[model samples]
Target: MASETIVPPTVGDQADCNEVNTCHVDEFLYDVEEVEKLAKKGKLKRQYCLDCNSRNITAYYFSNAGTIIGVEMNKECCEVQEKIINQYSMNQNRIKVIHSDVMDRSDIVASSNIIVANVLDFFVDIEKHKKIWYFFKQHIKKGSYLICNRSITDTLESIGLSEELIDWLSICKPCRQENEIFFDLEDFMDMHLYKVN
Candidate 1:
């Protein structure tokens, strides 16, 4: 199989996708690395992406991942992801890019072993944010890993961030796995590895 260097979207590629799905190459790579470590430990069998916008991550997983599902609500992003899949001749049976809201796909969310949910704050409103988080808290099966850029805990007061959601986290009591690699993104990104209870 031909391997292309994992490159971030260029100016032209950015135009192809929605503004919400901006090309954050370094952050995307960090998300991939965090999951890759778990995959190496045999902890990841089926992986899911909440806001999958990276072609590189998709390519890497399809090479050896057990089951990879990228749930992208953005139609344009899905098209870009699908093009990469088609170009690589990846096995569609193992890897799928479902163009739909993550909340609409409960079965996928419930069955995922590792879910990489990048910042979902861009797309949904305050109410929808609460609803989606509630859906995730309820659906994501126990023992599954939830990797998100934002803190699930209420470290600060922000719109759409609900106490009920944080309450659920406290109720479930998920263990936060730490990373040795530290990022200096000015606290713009906080990587939390939650092993669901």
Candidate 2:
């Protein structure tokens, strides 16, 4: 039997969509050393995230995804992944890029071992947020993880969604498993890691 060759993800020409998924790695700063320090202590596995504008985080993840494959979803016209696909031609197969909304894709969520979303609050409304939570509960497999910028507890409390949020997080128990490493980026934002129960 022959080993299959990995190909980079397919990307669109632009990233503009009715809604743009941007993980503002800069807006909410974090300490890189701290995240890496944590990541070194735990298991690092296949991961997924979306709306990789500017190709900054995508490139960063691209480097890491070499050993552990990841799936990145962006708008149909996303160029960040396209640029990365062109620059690191060899890594194209490591990270699969899909053009779709994070809320709309439960399949990807089911496959990923870890999912990270920065500035998730900025992307959708309260209703959409609920739907997102539903996706997390319904699709994210047990033992998988979720990393995000805002506190799910706080967000739920502020939005009067504590009950629902609690139910979901109870299964996706709040956890701190791995260190998140970002190139030149600090883990300034109080990002939380949750493990699905």
Candidate 3:
């Protein structure tokens, strides 16, 4: 069988349909499908630990997938999440979802094999960065991973992250508010994070 071209949804595309805050069923499915493909292609290696089992040492996703917990609360996004879950529930039994403020959920953190935050920098405040770091340190087990992506701005200093962290975390600049390929330093700050034990 030929592999399907899975075009993951963009943040702006969802925003346009007024589905940004709602459940993004399509996007969730795309993520699930993409993850599954990666695993099948040997792009994602299986991982195991005392807390959880994950097929991939590093996973990719959006902010909504991380934050929104309940299907009912995130109607649009959950629809997609549920569809994807149901489709691969058997093969992806270990994957689970927890909904809570990233700043507050120790249980979620403790249980997570890999934690992902998309566009998280927008939500972080300089004053609260330390607290957030402390939270991650407390809950994340050694050898686990943290993957995060965020837009770059002057607030980087406020986030208390070193330049090395920024370089290691960021993956690619997808786009800008102006709907153009991100090119400038201001645009270049979009980052991705991977937690290393």
Instruction: List where candidate 3 sits over 4 angstroms from the true fold.
Output: 1-76, 87-93, 128-130, 150-158, 161-197
RMSD of each candidate? 15.3, 18.5, 16.2
lDDT for each residue of candidate 1 in 147-171, tens digit (9 for 90 to 100): 7777766421365455545544432
* True-structure lDDT of candidate 2: 0.58
Best by TM-score: 1
- Per-residue C-alpha lDDT of model 2 across residues 1-197, encoded as one tens digit per residue: 13644333346653332223322222245476645554344332123345543223323543444433334444544567666566545455565567677766777778877877655567678888777777778888878777767777887776677886575554233434479534333444476667777
What is the lDDT for 165 in model 1? 56
Give the number of the best model, judged by lDDT: 1
lDDT of each: 0.67, 0.58, 0.50
Candidate 3 lDDT for residue 187: 44
Question: What is candidate 2's CA lDDT for residue 12?
Answer: 68
TM-score of each: 0.55, 0.53, 0.38
Which regions of candidate 1 are displaced past 4 Å?
A: 1-64, 154-157, 160-162, 167-189
Candidates sorted on TM-score, descending? 1, 2, 3
TM-score of 2: 0.53
